[model samples]
Target: MASSLHIDLHKISKFVNLSIPALFVVFLSAGHFVSFYFHFFTVAFLFMVIANFFYMTVQKEHVILKNFGLMGQARYIIESIGPEMRQYLFASDTEERPFNREERSEVYRKAKNIDSASSFGSQQNFDPSEIKIRHTMFPTPKEALQPFKITYGEERGLEFAYTITRPIMISAMSYGALGTNAVRSLARGAKLANIPMNTGEGGYPEYHLMEDCDLIFQIGTAKFGVRTDDGLLDDTKLAEIASKPQIRMIEIKFSQGAKPGKGGLLPKEKITDEIAKLRGIKKGADVVSPPYHPECDTVEKTVAFIKRVQNVSGLPTGFKICLGKVSEFEVLVEEMKRQDVYPDFITVDGAEGGTGAAPKAFLDGVGLPLLVGLASIQDCLKRHGIRNKMKLNASGKLISPRAQLVAFALGADAIYSARGFMLSLGCIQALQCGNNTCPIGITTHDPELQKGLVIESRAPRIANYVHNIEHDLEELLRATGCKSFSELTEENLYIPSDTVLGNYRLNSPEVQAAAS
Candidate 1:
């Protein structure tokens, strides 16, 4: 009887188990569509019936497991259901601890324009730190004020100085990994918020222009996005893109949080003709960027090239990177000290971020956490006495007020978020981004797969999320008694006292880098 039951269940699944009611629930709840719902159900039932019929006849489980193994089968069967499992087990409500659950909820509430005030009183479990918290004077704040503009270079001149219109902006995640609608929606949202969006190493995208969004185009190691006839950065090519009103900043990518000092990869399967053309590589072949740039090999040359980009573009240009050896940063700062050429800004990205696809070793081992890296860069500037010469921005997992505030307190002029924005656009963190099979349609080229993303609708949500976060950030700044984000100092914030006494202290820079 048990054997018969298993056989029947298998048959049912193979044939018309989609008749199982859940499939039609969305349709039924969608409208007063009693007839249409029934029609869909009937059609679905027939489809499942045929499917089950084949399944019963074939009965190939043993064959599948033998040929594909558990891992392979999991990809299709168990993994296909991974999203459902995560939603049911986890929540939009449960806090992510350490950096856990309730914390994420507060941010989501503020971003969604819902009440962020906790009901069961404050969620904090602060154990009374040894360090006393500090408050500020002139608590009332206004929008659109001074020093809110991020200044990068004084010696190099004002043209190189840049502004971060809002503390919250979109960080880099290339277009190839994120679909057309996703890019469009994000750009539209950034335009509405008057913040900048960093186009990942994928280069300048046309969809970014369509939305009239301000942008920071990233230059990867291979110089993939903007290239000369020899596939290097072309002045004309840079100018053509820079001439547009929306294009705002440029960054030369040396390394990232997920995999610093590693080469880039676009699997052979993803090397579409269009992507190949945009990146100036060939299609159907695995695309890899050299481990380093051919031109900017030395620290001095890197700074020189940065100036070349800024000189030609007439817009802010800088570098987005993870802090590694102090010696290398010291060398680069030494070059800046000698040459008087400064990048418009420096974005300190943390190791907490993700990549399209990177080796497990690099992902786990390379780069520094955002806090350490940002603070290191800040200290470098401060110690070098050139702190005032460049704007410092923070990237990597910055979304909520606390995260933004932390960055601001740590001396970052602004913070940028990529995955968090992806979440606001309805990503459930399925972790399928690099595979070209994102169920959310944020990362794929297949037309059939792109149906899930609706640009016009999702675009507004993105805009709404950005607007809410920016306004709330202003509120937090006001509550802390600062007039502008630039004026916000470390005295306005607090951290766990133990964290200072612990491992963080060991990693702290021995000599502060001078900031002029």
Candidate 2:
């Protein structure tokens, strides 16, 4: 009997850490003419102790929870908020993960029309092996330079072909992926900046066309906006969409940077009633776009599809893709040349590009970075002697003037950014985009959160960001002594390595000879 009692006491002592606190609370409540607060506190602590016992014995998922009991909850609590704590407390300005503090700060400052000049000294380590653009001692005379603009589909000879007023346009960000206010603000802001806004693969909603912004309507693999009930392309619906005057170009999205070879995902939580209606999907269901285009299954079919859309729409047509099987693009270019067909433009999305949501495998390891991918695509097209037929738009982390300049030197005819504009609209880089609870209302559907983003106010910031970036771009072009982007060349830019870099340009005699 004595031994059994000692054993029972030992087990009880093991939980004394929790029991002591509960006993103290209960003692206080019983000793005093208990206030309502004390009663509630005592009850809560007792409930927790009982719950902790059940969790310790029954919970099998985590060993710590079973072994350490309630105290182990600290691990999960700390883990849940770890990202937030690190971002605010520990991350350095130049620590580039998604977007570094410095990058986001610059966008925010420029958007707000605040002084964005850097002070003191540079934060970056001047690595000798880094690629740098050559700025001539004598810059081009600003008085003789023309305003920023670029035209697509000049070779295609279409009446409604796009003549973009600015090289920096809003990249494709779908209505379903973003909040209603975000889409509307982007539309209004693009109108103010006189720049084009892409309607991402989700589909075109009325908000996209609400402000007379030039829109590049994108047809994704699922063909959401223009699909028939059977999930096939409906030419009648496509024609009707194309009839809109504000719709200047049509893009067939083959893949995006963040999730190349992966489909677009709108978690069930994000599929609001309006989104379901716009995308023509059932509400409260996960919206997953197909990984591949249903219509463009082969290279020949893809070219034919582009021509079909162009013919039906009477607008410049193109495709957007990230770097994949290199030989695939080679085959695509070859087929286009052989068939005497060409897209109006090709948008090369870098792997570092932003997405609303994607798997870790696709996001981190799937595609080529923007620099390599853009150069490769450019080289492939140029080698085939068909580069002149189409424009090349580069999309990735082109928030900075230097990044844009590097892209232009690598053969980008234009640049676009989605996340940069989101920053302009007051994104704090909370990294909660995948969840439907974006605190800033940019990517959330919560009415209260959406109210925080006032379109009338943020629209000006968007316009300002666009203006400032273009101004900075012009400054860089002037420094390089280039009259326009057309005057920029690979020779003007230098890679810092002594070893000869693998030239992406394939039209050179040596490359042609090697290929033959």
Candidate 3:
């Protein structure tokens, strides 16, 4: 009996490591000293009662705690362990979700190049009567090709013609906010995997030039990082950056999922003299991005702006947006058709997207979730008969093969992942990224934390994850009899929840035109 208690106690310590007196008891109890053990047990009993009483009585975010209480500090410690506690105590195999332990374990094993295949039981268990199911019919036979390549965006025109080899592309994170090494590593990783990396709204960092990988230059409303004297598109800057062979695409950041309609903010401390000079903003002041672009107002102006950059840059030009109103999109499409201008691609980010910092209301409340936005965007484009005009990219929690496949099957030419890369660099999802105290250096500017992230070692792991997911997708493609990823059509996917099993096929609005 004592041996069993010791084993269980050790397991608790291994998982939680509470960093408190209660945990000290658990550690000593396993030491095989029975007489002194009663004293340790008494201490443990007292600690548990005091800790629970302190934790359960008050909500952490209460104003009282903020003004004059220690409650918030205690809550912070407890919240930090939320992941470990959920995993060890309450989460059964069936209950774990949102990139569950099972999926995370699989990623780790596959990264090590081990064969991590599911055995026997299903990865998911549905309530027999409550859930719905749907599937495709007349499935095509699988074909042969590259290991990690797959189709990512919409399949209609300039986009339908190309395929993304790896599902794991870098997310839209600004460079000024991240250290020089962070940007360099991301670029190097993308170069190694034949994938692309987005140079966030902060503009093209000089360090990003070193790796010479595929680049997606982002232009935001603030126009802080790159703009001319007229405070508009800088032709010289765009031409120089876009002329680089590594720069494959450009994305205008109209809005993002995290804080739709809200603008960018650079704290006084972060607004370094260098960034201020480059951005044309005064130093030592709070930098607030304009809510909308002063240079462009309507869809016509928006398209013209896109054309301005595309004409000088001579590369694929796209825009990233989190959808809001359907009518707004309809208007935009109508204007695009009328003006005879087309975007090379569009990225739809889900409302659940995360950023280093954003207003709470916008983070929780604004923009449509990605699945809904993708459906809306897809349906609108098809209805406008402009589906053939552009490719589609999806972002927001699309790190694994299944998630990426769902985005593609629904309607996305490619997908981007942010938190996933952070994960590769040893982020435990502690949510402390916005502060300059990140322990693993995935999201902070602190030199000490930055030391922990070995860009050299971690970049390859990032590449490994990209390759691993693509290989997994290849298995699915093989099951669908598709040799080339570009050949995958919506007819290959079905939601089991809908009860539409292998009975139907999807048709693009211009299916006839493509067929002809």
Candidate 4:
């Protein structure tokens, strides 16, 4: 009898799990005679006990509920908040994905105009497969590094041949994707920094033009701002939008890195009346853009559409793409050559570059990464003898000066950073971008949340971010013994021999010829 009464440690969980439901049942049985003051509490407790008892004994769907009863619910609650727990407490500085604590801290420091120097050596693993920049014995003086400038539409000679002095520009992020304050803040920052900002294909540039900054109006697959009733590009609307003095260039987005084949998605919960009106969409349904433009079903048609937009808008026009098939891109270049027509610029979006929400499969397994895609696109254009015809802009996870320099060495003429600018705007990386409940107000439309993002304070941060990047870029260029970005070449970069990228670089015709 004594042995039977002893508690077995191994069965403690099972005992507790059964005891909890039994206690609730007993408490509820005694609640019938409770006084009037305890009536409300008794009813609430009775409901909870009954529901849990039903789940434990009757519900066959969840085995945990059947075995552990109310205790099983705690497991679900903990699991639901697991991501937040890992992000804030469990994960180390470099263990997080998308952007780690160390990377985000660097951006925040630069944005705040504070010294971002690190005391210790890099926390990075310094794996043999990693890429490194080759510094020269003879470093160039800072004065020797000339100011960088890239002129769009220089080859075509458009009426507005936009020249950007700085290589870093704000990437496309639609007003609908962001709040009014966020957009205006970015515009003011762009004005302060004397840089261009892309109006992410959000139908209208109303908020983007608030501060009189240079604007690159993006025409997405849906043709939001310049679409006809039939969902095709409207020349009249396109001309009207292009007529705005702030509009300097036009980018036709073929695809972004987040979801290569999948189109843009805006949750219905985020669709406000203003957003619905601006996008010409209904309020109740999720907004899913067409995977491809209806008018651009083939490569030839795509080129023709580009020409049409350029002709109508009379602006420097280009296209943004997340490179998927090399063969398809080779065909596209061929078509451009055959037609004797080329875009003013080409924005190569890497698979790793997505500031918007997207499906897990598409985000994880889709287009080529920036380094590989940019190199391939540059190689293809060079092979076709049209490398000089269009400016090449690269966008991915390039938030720092070193990363930007690597892109230049690989063939990027300019750099666009969406997440970098986002961080500068005080994003906490809550990973709640898809939901409408962004605590920081950068991505949320909620007025209460937006109150946190004061435009006056945030705008300078953006300008500071750009200035700091420019300063560091010049410093890096001087260290590389390069007078200007034009002097950077693939030889200025070194990759470990065992990496796939290294093997490709070593065997490439260009490197082989140079080696010989």
Maximum-lDDT candidate: 4
Model 3 sits at a Cα RMSD from the real structure of: 9.3
- The superposed Cα distance between candidate 4 and the true structure at residue 478, in angstroms, equals 0.8
Question: Per-residue alpha-carbon lDDT of model 4 for 1-516, expressed as tens digits?
Answer: 678689764376577656655665555556656545555555666566677778778899998888767667778999999999998899999988888999999999999999988987998878877788899999998777788998999899777899999979999999978888999999999999999999998988889988999999999888888887656898998999999999999999999998888876667986778877776667798766898888999989999999998899899999999999888999999999998889999999999997657889999999889888888899999999999999999999999888899999989999999999999999989888878688889888889999999999999999999999999988888888999897898888887877656776777767888999
lDDT (tens digit, per residue) of candidate 3 on 377-441? 88789888887778778898776677677667667867788766656555555556577666667
- Candidate 2 residues 309-367, lDDT tens each? 88888888999999887789999898898889899999999999998888988899998
Report the alpha-carbon TM-score of model 2 versus the true structure: 0.90
User: Which ten contiguous residues of candidate 3 have the minimum total lDDT?
Assistant: 499-508
Task: Identify the runs in model 3 with alpha carbons over 4 angstroms from their true place.
Answer: 1-100, 123-164, 229-231, 277-281, 483-489, 496-516
Candidate 3 TM-score, C-alpha based: 0.74
How well does candidate 1 score on lDDT at residue 388? 78
TM-score of each: 0.77, 0.90, 0.74, 0.91
Given candidate 3, what's the lDDT at residue 210? 81
* Candidate ordering by TM-score (highest first): 4, 2, 1, 3
Q: Which one is best on TM-score?
A: 4
The per-prediction tally of clashing pairs is 37, 0, 28, 0
